[model samples]
Target: MACQDSDTARLIDVELDESVGRGTPDVEHERAVAIFDLVEENSFRPVGDSGEGPYKLKLSLVEARLVFAISRENGEAVVTHILSLTPFRRIVKDYFLICESYYDAIRSATPSQIEAIDMGRRGLHNEGSQTLMDRLKDKIDVDFDTARRLFTLVCVLHWRG
Candidate 1:
C-alpha cells in the first residue's frame, strides 16, 4: 500500500474565457505555467457542499470582476464566487512593473541585481496571493499555494480587456 496526499484539490479541467485576447509571449507563458501548476496541485474545497473533488474550474472576468465557477468531476455545480477587482488593482500594477524589471534585468543586469528584483517580485506575488485568500475566506477554502496559482491566472485575465 502506498500513501497518497489527499489534502490538495486537483483540477481535472480548467477553462479561460474565449473573449480574452492572446497576449504577449511572456503573458502566455505565465498563463501556461500557472495553469500547469494549478492543475498539478491545489487546495480547493467549496463551502456548504458535500461533494468531494478533483474539481473543474472555469475562470473569467465579468463586468470588471473575477469569477470562479467550480464544479465536481461529475459536472455538478459546487459553488460560484465573484470577486471584486478593486482591491487587486494596485497589487497587480506593482506585480507587472516588477515583472518587467525582472525580465529586463535577466537580459542586461548583473546577477545580483536580478536577484534583488526577483526577491521584490516574489514578495509582491505573496502579497497578492494573501489578498486572494482573504477574499475567498468564508466562501471557499484554499491554501496559500493554491491562492498563488489562482492569482497568476487572475493576472493573466486582468492583462486583457
Candidate 2:
C-alpha cells in the first residue's frame, strides 16, 4: 500500500446509519462502538505481537496512538481501528463499520456504503493503500475483496485526553 496525503477526504462522524441497498447492514453499529471503546482500553498491542482482537496500528506520529479490533457477528468480521493524537487533530474523527448485523441478520448494503467505508480508510500507508482497512486485511491475511467487506464492520471509538 502507498501513503499519500489526502486533502479531499473528510473523516466521517455521523452516528451510524444503516445502508439503503444490497450490501451489509448496520444493526451492530452501536455495539461495535461500545466494543471499540472496550478494546481500546484493554487491548492495545502492536500488530503481530500475539493473540487476537484489539490489534495496534503500524503507523502514527510519535505523539499519536492508533489501535484496532475485530468483532464477529453472525459470522461477519467487523474490523475496527482508532487513531488518537494528544494535541488533537482539530476535531476527533470516527470511521465506523459500514457492514453490520441487524434483525438477527445483516442489512442490505449499497455501493454508497462501500464508498463510505473506503473514504474512512483513505490515506492509509500500508502495502495496499495505507488505509487501516488494508492493514487489517494484511494482518488477517484474507483476500482483498473479503478483507474489504469485512473491514466495513470494523468500528472506531475515541476518548479526548
Candidate 3:
C-alpha cells in the first residue's frame, strides 16, 4: 500500500511496557526481532492529523485493554488508543497453542510434520494480523506486514511464559 515518504511514515522506535512480564528466552528473542523488524520497515500513520510521521510506539495492556501509546519522534504527544482485547482473545489463545505444538514438533517430529504445524501457526498469525488491522482501521492505518508485526507485539504482551 502507498504511504507517506518512507522515512516519515515508518516507526523510528518501538517499545513494550516494562510492566509486561518477560517470557521465555525464545519468546524474548521473538519479541526483540519483531520490534527490530517493525522499526526497520513499517507504514504507520495515525488517522487524522494526530501528528507528523516517524512515530514512537509503546504497546501495553491495561485492565484487559490494549493500549497503543503513540508519539512524535521528538517526544511530542500524539494519540493514545485503547482498544478492546476481546476481539483478539480467541486468536491469541489459539496461536499460543499452535506455537507450542510447532515448537514441540521441531524437536522430534518429521520434517513434514514440522512444516504442517508451522503452516497452521502462520495461518493463525495471519488471522490475528487481519483482526488487528480491522480493529485499528479507524485509529491507525497499517499495511499487512505492519499489522503482522504489531500482532506479534500484542502477543508478546500476552505472553506469560
Candidate 4:
C-alpha cells in the first residue's frame, strides 16, 4: 500500500535497545534489514491523543517485558507501552528451532526439504505476528504487514546468543 503524504500515522524511525546484544553477523543483518523495511513502509499510530504524524519507535526488553517507546518525528514524547513477553516465548522458541533447521537444510538438504522447513518457519512467524497484533490492539493500530516486520524485530530482541 502506498503511503500518502497526509498519512502521518506511519513510523519514520525505529530503534532497538542497545542492551540487547547483537548475535552473529546473520542476526545483525536481519536486524538491519527489518529496521530498513519497517522505516520504508509501515502503519503505526498510537491509540488516543498521544501525538501526530510520522512517529519514532524504540523497542526494548526490560525486566522480561517488551517496551515500546514512541515519539513524534521531532522527538517529542508520546505514549509508552510495556507488554508482557510471556505470550511470545513459546512461539519465539519454535521459530528459532525452525530457522535453525532451515539454515542447516540449505547446506545439503534437497530443495524440497529446505522449502518444507521454510514453510514451518513462516507459519511460526505468522503466529507470532498475529499475537503481536492482538497484544497491541488496545495500545496501537498496525497493519498486518507492519505487525510482521515488527514481530521480526521483537524476535531479534529475544535473541540470547
Candidate 5:
C-alpha cells in the first residue's frame, strides 16, 4: 500500500484462493521484485538465484498482509500468485540502498514502519550518545559524520562477508 503507481510497479497476475482471505484473488505485482530476491533476512546478504527462464512471481494476501514469491517460467517473471502475509521480511543492503536512494521512502513510511524501526534500534545505542553539535572551528555538519559512519559500517559488514 505504501507503493505509488508513478513508478515501474506492474501488475503481473491474479488468482483466486480458498484459504487466508475470503473471495479476494491474489493480485501479483512486480514493482521492484528483484528487491525481494536480493535481500536476505537479518544477516542482510544477497545470494544470486538468477537462472534460465520464465520468472514466475506469486503474491498471496493473508492476515491483511502481502506476501510474494518469484520463480522462472519463460525467460520472464511470470508471477503466478499473491498472498497477504508478511513473513521473512529481510533488510538487505539493497533495501538499505533503496531506502537511502529515496529518503522520501522513509519520510512517508507508515506508523508501523516507524514503530518497527524504533523497536529494532532498541539497545543498539548507549546512553548519552546523542549530542548537540558544538560550534567548532572547522564548521561541518555532524550529520556528515553520521553518514560516514554508516558507510564505513556497511563496508565493514561486506568485508566480513
Candidate 6:
C-alpha cells in the first residue's frame, strides 16, 4: 500500500513565519496550542483548482495582510491567499487587553472577575474568527473552530509583526 493515505482537504501541519520575540510566555503557549489544535482537527479547503490538500500551511504577516501559504503533503505549492488584517485590528486589540485582564485576574482577582474577563475574551475571539471567515469566504473554507484557532495564530503574528 502507499505510505500516504487518501488526500483530503485539511490542515496537517502549520508554521509561523517569525518568532514572537521576547517575554511573552503566555502568547507562546497560545501559539503552540493553536497549532496543535488545528492539526489535530480542522477543516481547510482552498477554493478553485488548488488540487488535493491534506495540506501544510504557513501563516505569515506580509505588509498589512495575513498570508496563508498552502502546500500539499508532498510539498507542492497549492495556493496562497493574503487576507487584509484591517477588519480584525480592533477586535484583536480588544482580545489582547481582555486576555491580559483574565490572566491577571487568575493570579489575584476573584473567580467571578476572572470569569467575566474570560467571557469577554471569548466573545472578542469569536468575533475576530468570524471576520476572518468572512474575509476568506471566496478563497478558503474553514470551520468556526479552525477559524478560531487560526485567529489566535494571527493575533500572535500581528503581535510581533
Q: Which candidate wins on TM-score?
A: 3
TM-score of 1: 0.87
Worst 10 residues of 6 by lDDT: 1-10
Highest lDDT scorer: 3
Clashes of 5: 27
Candidates by TM-score, descending order: 3, 4, 1, 6, 2, 5
Cα-based lDDT for every prediction: 0.81, 0.32, 0.87, 0.86, 0.29, 0.79
lDDT of 1 by residue, 108-153 (tens): 9999999999999999999999999999888877778888988888
TM-score of each: 0.87, 0.22, 0.91, 0.89, 0.22, 0.84
The CA lDDT at 99 in model 2 is 20
Superior by lDDT: candidate 3 or candidate 6: 3
| Evaluation by TM-score, superior candidate among 4 and 5 | 4
- The segments of candidate 3 whose C-alpha lies over 4 angstroms from its true place after superposition are 23-27
Q: Compute the lDDT of residue 144 as modeled in candidate 2.
A: 35
User: In candidate 2, which residue ranges exceed 4 Å CA deviation?
Assistant: 1-29, 32-63, 68-130, 136-138, 144-146, 153-161
**Candidate 1 regions off by >4 Å?**
1-8, 19-21, 24-26
Which window of ten consecutive residues has the lowest lDDT sum in model 2?
3-12
lDDT of 5 by residue, 23-116 (tens): 2121122222322322211111002332332223343445544333444434344232232222212223434444343455467888777666
Error of 2 at 139 (Å): 3.5
Question: After aligning candidate 6 to the native by TM-score, how far in Å is the CA of 34 from where it should be?
Answer: 1.9
Clash statistics: count for each candidate: 0, 16, 0, 0, 27, 0
Compared with the true structure, what per-residue lDDT tens digits does model 2 show for residues 1-161?
A: 21121211111111232221122233345445544443333212223323333222222122354443443322233445554433222222322121222211225557676565555444221112224334443344333332233233232223211
